[model samples]
Target: MSMNDSWYRASVGDVTQRDALQGDITTDVCIVGAGFTGLSAALELAEAGVRVTVLEAEQVGWGCSGRNGGQINPGLGCDHGRVVAELGADDARKVWQLTLDGVELLRSRVKRHNIDCDLKAGILLVANKARHVPELQSWQHELEALGYDQLAFYDRDALQSLLKADYQAGVMDWGGGDLHPLKYALGLASAAEAAGAQILERSAVLGYEEDGRTVTIRTAAGQVHAQHLLLAGNAYLGKLLPWYRKGFMPIGSYVGATRPLGELATQLIPSRAAVCDMNTLIDYYRLSADNRLLFGGRASARDAQPNALRATMRERMALVFPALAEEDFEYLWGGQVAMTMSKAPVFGRLGRRTLFAQGYSGQGVALAGMAGKLMAQTVQGDAAGFDLMARAKHWPVPPGAPLQTAIRALALLWYRLQDSR
Candidate 1:
């Protein structure tokens, strides 16, 4: 489907367009990609009285930030137990707390800026299979032990009362919820601009060169010389920084929005909480402000044809709610999700002046904004939070595209097998 057909684009009303980079400029920090990460940093830095310039390849929030599932899920992309095992209890607790803080940060931003993004509360992580039930229960206990108390376990009957799905069990996270992703992103951009940052759209960065003291970023029409550079492009970073590409694989995830389901929507999800199964390759969905069932799943390492994407999404959605098999999808679109080998976010510094954070996997809605804030803190001489995230190890994929593709295919195949079991 044409990206222009995105329901987010249609629902966001009109946004003020900014001019592209037109002439050489200098700033304290030059950020590339005006998505959540960059825009969040811009808002923080600008408010701190720092000269920040954000250059976007397209309009602000044009990437996954604007097109994500909008589920404000708390915690890391990977399992919390694995994180505790890898980083140990103390650091892992800190990391877990940061994720929770991320959710709150998003809420505070919406309230502080009066962002009309339809923010809501509650999320259900349902068990797709009987085997997954024990795992979800254990996870909930683990979080409770770590001082998080806003979770509740639900049996199949209890889950059925809330969500009309044949799931075995579920864990309700009262802290997490959903929102209009594009509107949240646009609000951030506007807040950042109002805070004294300059945002340039349609100014794709061609390349950049640094000479010890300063980094010069080039665009088609202009260049930016700044003391520091932040790369926040995520999957869309492309070949700008090839080394970072090896650390994450860009996976295409598609979402389909059914025509407003009205009362059917409330019947399917009475709690109005965003829901997702616990499969290795899970199906996530939530109700839009207008009551449309916005379902998402069917991810692939490589891009698929739009028709095929829509068909697969339809099939997936039908699997959850068979009554909607014949429902018409009013909108369908795909966005790139950067998945690291470990599924943890990748944050680190390059040399002394360049920094980057990406590979949020499918958990960028809240975390990405927090990451940007932490990164800005690092730039302003406080690296505690950013340092903790940077400490997590992220292995790089094989060097070649062909090898990487093969690895991703094998991984997906393995996940499929696990899901089937």
Candidate 2:
């Protein structure tokens, strides 16, 4: 296969296809990158009677959207306390509510569109270290103070009952869940197309020019002139826009799928909750609808696959479920996540008619799709919620790729050290 194959691709049934852009076209809104964010935005815009076009460099969900751990987490990549400290109580509350809105938006879309993506309904945030228990407690308390209380704390005993993992403690959030990400992406694309949106796969955006009135996007096959533009490509945007490159570091995250665990799957996670650890670089895993143990962790500044990727992942799995140490891992893949210095998503206008959202860190499964809806709302002249997210601070990455990589390595090393303690 030309692309890094994923278990998701193997398991999903037939996918919808749209022809590539053949000639120049005009649209009310033009979106680049047809992943969750772009498709979600396109669906909302098309439903509202707007002419929208989505350009994809690869197949829909070919990026991290399809390869993620499939955890539909509620909050941003950072902790709630950190959010309040950085964005302040008022703005932090607004952002928290946006996450809640994101979860609701996902649930509503899945139901309204009748999208069957194996949608599950719970996520367990477990502590990797005993020292992290107090931090988890603080997080639960903070969310409750903000009037959002869907979390149920779990002691070590409770965690062991549900997950045979070496976790210290955990909190289960009924508000969060997991799903088949690629199926969800395809479902959104289908819904968008059904609403009259045009999606052109294999149509990579070359560049664009916005003359205040309208933006003209040039691609290999065609050009698109639109009154507004949405750059939803995230880490895959590359150098298509120079300024955007400075806002986020594209880091590689790895995931693996095991052979079906059969009855052992239910025994491991009896409640069938998606689970993640609390370290800066954490381990996340869930049982697939087919009973495979899909586990993900490990990160790299470069795109190079880790030496012995499957072996390392299997070792990690053994730590969680020693009974499954011999379980055969059938799939190993990695994808880039756009991580910002602030660990908050970067959202704002490029000039006047151009808008973009990226740096979802590693929590893009739900938030990215919701951001697309927020982008659609912004295009419709409603920018309240979008602006709230755009208000979060972002620093430009240093000019050189080598320097940026080194800085990220140093920063991640420090985080790893902290996690070790």
Candidate 3:
């Protein structure tokens, strides 16, 4: 099977194709999907001496995990301030700490496993409009109240000095970072395998059969019978498990990596920070370690390729740094992510033995990795934190999903209007 033309595929060379499911293969645990959550869970499980087998429908990292903007940013997709407003300050504090720990956990994994994915430090939360400066300031205030310190303010004047665009301001998070997403995913898979987790590529799970305490994952070429099952197939999970899919509406995001930018890349963001805008449907771009500008945004709920990659993304990237208006695009591809109505991740039980987690929106890089380990903890009877996250109800797409696309379009229009204002 041909892999998607993701930035990771281009940067990391060809993905190894594993034959589809074959005969019966039993294990202590069976995890579907080779993306962040699945592989993260596998890595943790194997470390704990848990027998684990990870099955990917295609090659590992062949999903959004390898094909995103690669911004290992902190926090969920929504504003941490919004979280404070909705869930009260105490709960919001807990969530905020979790996100902080999420980033820390990601860094620890990369270092502990000796994985070299070009983990660069710092991410800039750039404001596209002048009005957004207040929000960034307010966020800084809240973080200060929370005793968080690691971010620097880049005022309009400061932005002009460091950037080539006419932007209002940006919040530079010294703690957050960027990386080669595909390479990171592959490294995670390799680490899990080294730790005793069985990883097989091209194993599309067809169906699962259960009898008493044993659950058998039936793949096209083989079957994995295990006592515990974890469903980490975020958006590629077509119908292997209908209940898990119901919690999220699959949506697509496109990314285009320009030809390496050489010195211009460092000049764009001297700190080489990942840049994301302030909007519900926003644009995010960052410089690859190799200096290619990786830009991502523009949501599509259906199966549609970007209309004009160079023109659209280059325009958006130029919005942040107009110096890249004519940057040459090297590869353009789209990958789908599971999005819940609340935009928070869903992690809970499916039936009695199966554990499920998905819908990280766009901030799954670290969150998903942490989620997998937490899910493993949940399986081991430590469910306090996992329950809190799982209990976060997901407002799924409309029953027929007929209005989802339209709703997202209108929602984008409304946010765009608000952003412009």
User: Which candidate number maximizes TM-score?
Assistant: 1
- lDDT of predicted model 3: 0.79
> Which lDDT value does model 2 have at 42?
98
Off by more than 4 A, model 2: 1-4, 244-246, 306-308
Off by over 4 Å in 1: 244-246
Best first by TM-score, ranked: 1, 2, 3
Task: List model 1 lDDT by residue over 5-105, tens digit each.
Answer: 67888898888989999989999999999998999999999999999999999998889988888998889988887788888989999999999989999
Instruction: List the lowest-lDDT window of 10 residues for candidate 3.
Output: 1-10
Question: How well is each residue in 137-220 modelled by candidate 3, as lDDT tens digits?
Answer: 898787878878887889888865555556689888888888888888888988898999988887888888778799988876
How close is every model to the real structure, measured as TM-score? 0.98, 0.96, 0.93
Summing lDDT over every window of 10 consecutive residues in candidate 2, give the lowest-scoring window.
Answer: 1-10
Q: Residue-wise lDDT of candidate 2 within 1-421, one digit each (tens)?
A: 2234688988886676668888899999999998989998999999999999999998998887878888988889877777888779888888888888888899999999999899989999999887899989998998888887789998988887777777889999999999999889889999999999999998999999988799999988889999999999998897766753448888888888888989989998988999988888788999999899899988777786644567777888888889987786788888888998878898888888888888898879889987999999999999998988887777887767798789878988988898888
lDDT of 1 at 379: 90
How does residue 377 of candidate 1 score in lDDT? 90
For all the candidates, what are their Cα RMSDs to the real structure? 1.3, 1.6, 2.2
Worst 10 residues of 1 by lDDT: 238-247
Measured by lDDT, the strongest candidate is 1
